[model samples]
Target: MKRRAHLAGLLALPMFWLIGIYIFSLVMLLVTAFWTTDPFTSKVKPGFTLRNFEQLVANPAYLSTAVRTLVIALAVTVLCMLISVPLGIFMAKIAKPWLRALLAVAITLPLWAGYLVKILAMRVTFTDAGFFNWALAPFGITGPSFSITTVVLTLTYLWLPYMAVPVYTAIRQLPANLFDASADLGAGAWRTIRTIVLPLIKPAIIAGSIFTFSLSLGDYIAAKFVGGSTQMIGSIIASNINLNPPIAAAFAVVPIAFVVIYLLSVQRTGALERM
Candidate 1:
């Protein structure tokens, strides 16, 4: 009884915050999404309506922005996985202790920098008169201007550490004998990884992707800094939040629904449980 009481006590605060704050906020957002905006006064009108959602679906611009946001989010996730796996294996399986520490530090160092600063730095690098263009000038290669590609690259740089660190940690926690056993069985490096290492690290990869995908989905600042005129779902929400809050709320539901569906789908794979 005492142990149960203590456990309940420990959980009470978090449970309150989750239910009272987070869930309540979501409820409010849902209610707000059904509201209507008065065009004459440009004020939010309290009511239930499907016009906001109908408009959201009917607007080509909004649809394009949603698709673009999803594409960028997916691109960032894939790019991070591509970069993390080989680097994580090297750090966990091969690098010396000091070298591993150095690599870990290198991977995490960018995270300490301000997010705005990083976006601005990318903006500078991708600009025509900036470092990237200057370096490529001798090779007669032009630098990429602010565009969807720039947005993806900047976001990938920002979120790579989130994916890499978890993947590296997962690899480190793996039993060393697994690799040795695979080697004894005549399994090559790639084959061992495909059969054993990859399977074990799948949970960690999913965990990292949750961070990258959700962050990229909601990112407006990076798009603002380096996306030129390209707008994302986040930017659309930002634009409408004050003048037409109902529409913003309606659009906000898109990413929220995407993330919830994604989580539910991956949960079936046992990724969330492992995390």
Candidate 2:
């Protein structure tokens, strides 16, 4: 009884800290959202109102930018899944341990080499006279410059490894006997995969998708650097922070909402228990 109580108290400590930070931040935002600056005095007036949300809703540009962020985030998430799923299966199901290990290392090592520098390298190759265009110039394939495409591609490169790692681990942990049993029962490769493998690995897919979506949504640096005029929620919040704290708070909360909902769904699905 005493042990249970002590453990409960210990667990409560971090939860308390997290709750305190969230509540404190929310309160500050509520206060600042209502604050009015005196015209002549340049002093802040502590009050309450709904001007921030009203302004956010009324501004078409803000709404459009938010939509663009969600669209791009969805695109990135889908692309990561499409790329990682096959790669993870190949790496996990390969007959040789050395081959699997080499592929795993290849997929993972580039992640630690600094993401910003990778974005810069991508930018360098896309320049008109850069290597990519230089190679294509001889083939007479030229077109207008692209910034949005560059940003999306850069983010995909950055997050593909994150998606691959989890899916690979999930696939590797799956029982080898299950595959053999299915084959012995005259199940084809695709049939075995569809019936036995997919359900087991769905949890990993969920995890990887959550990571890819959340990271891409919350990321400020990549959106700001590669995204040029492609305004996203991150930059929107940044712009509003000093000038309009309440609205910025609202913008930041959207991503937090996504993360919380995803976490709750994962918990309900017992997805993380396997991890």
lDDT of each: 0.94, 0.76
| Candidate 1 lDDT tens digits, 174-207 | 9999999999999999999999999999999999
TM-score of each: 0.95, 0.82
- Could you tell me which residue pairs clash in candidate 2? none
In model 1, the runs with Cα more than 4 Å from the true position are 1-8
Model 2 lDDT per residue over 1-275, tens place: 99999998998978777778877867676567666545565455677667766777888877787777777777888898888777877888864899888888889888889877987777677667676777788789862334666667777888888788888888888888999999999999889878998788888888888878887887667666656667778888888676656667656666767678768887898877865
Off by over 4 Å in 2: 1-5, 26-31, 34-45, 135-145, 259-275
The whole-model C-alpha lDDT of candidate 2 against the native structure comes to 0.76
In angstroms, the error of model 1 at 220 is 1.1
